[model samples]
Target: MLAPVDDVVAWGESLDHLLECKTGQLVFENFLRTEYSEENLLFWLASEDYKKITSESEMKAVAKRIYAEFVEVDAPRQINIDCVTRGEISKNLSQPGPNCFDRAQRLIYGLMENDCYPRFLKSDIYQALLEQQ
Candidate 1:
């Protein structure tokens, strides 16, 4: 992971742009890891995956797993979300749909877009990469 990344410049375009690019996601993910707040990105990623399930049964199973791993109270990698958002996700658990995590996902997206992403652009890691590129 230490290799100098190409196309680093494109990542600064926007959060969506960064998330969409494979290399951008890695760079951003590594940046988040250093801040010890990788959970937000991880949750956001799980939400994306949850949205792609084709079957209702499969989607429900993945939803519960996503909740257990990320949304539930005391989840091992519990994301920083408000009780209302958390409660909404909890309410949808039993008959969860693909969009069950939508609210929490949007909230986390806002957190990353407004907070973490800015710092990432300013981080030594990103700066050094820019210098390399």
Candidate 2:
């Protein structure tokens, strides 16, 4: 059963606010999975982790791994970014930096905010969580 409309609205306020909370992010990710868009969140999370690497070699390795896993053509989790962003990332590969994926990350973030976020707010799972509370 779903929660009261007011309850769900009160809990989330907005998708951006919801995403700021750990539980909300988990719920949002689960919702993304239903639409086969989970990679958006996964890539965002990976980029966050990638930015934390302190060692130059480690940063380069992690950046390469992220590209292979998420940015490369035909990557298992290839995100829906434009060629220009992809080209920028490819260029950055020569001298990997923590900011290498920043442009792509922002694009993905916008995608989620404009596309998936509204759907998640309406998903049964999100309402169910509110009902439980």
Candidate 3:
């Protein structure tokens, strides 16, 4: 659902609030693209999706895909993360658990919260959305 004016205003109050709203995520994704940091947001989104998997085979396939796309060395859309976190994820990719990407997700979420969310609130894109409301 699209966020109302009040919900848009609330997006400024916390990154969690913004992420929880689909419209907010789209706007934020747009903002992140402009900043050339969309990879982090993509990884974060994928991790959230990974948590909802039910089929074991599907989960394993997704785990491999996520690893190849965002976690592996020289991944096409690699997210910025410490070696320790990357190493841990790499080691666990074989097992493919639901929470396997938790650490990397947290790191990316924190990066967005501290570095991107503030800018998003102040951005013209976001401001225009608020203006329209």
TM value for model 3: 0.94
Instruction: For residues 1-133, write the lDDT of model 3, one tens digit per residue.
Output: 2469987988888998888888888989989999999999899999999999999899999999999999988999999999999999888877889999999999998899889988988899988878878
The window of 10 residues in a row where model 3 has the poorest summed lDDT is: 1-10
**Model 3 regions more than 4 Å off:** 1-3
Among the numbered candidates, top TM-score falls to 3
What's the lDDT for all of these models? Answer: 0.87, 0.84, 0.90
In TM-score terms, candidate 1 sits at: 0.92
What tens digits encode model 2's per-residue C-alpha lDDT throughout 50-124?
999999999988899999989999999999999999999999997998899999999999998889987877788
Quick one: RMSD of model 1?
1.8
Of the candidates shown, which would achieve the greatest lDDT relative to the real structure? 3
Model 2, runs deviating above 4 Å: 1-11
Worst 10 residues of 2 by lDDT: 1-10
* Shift of residue 30 alpha carbon in model 2, Å: 1.2
lDDT of 3: 0.90
Per-candidate Cα RMSD to the true structure, in Å, reads 1.8, 3.3, 1.6
Residue by residue across 99-131, what tens digits does model 1's lDDT show? 899999999999999999999999998888888
Q: Tell me the deviation in Å of residue 65 in model 3.
A: 0.5
* Candidate numbers, best lDDT first, in rank order: 3, 1, 2
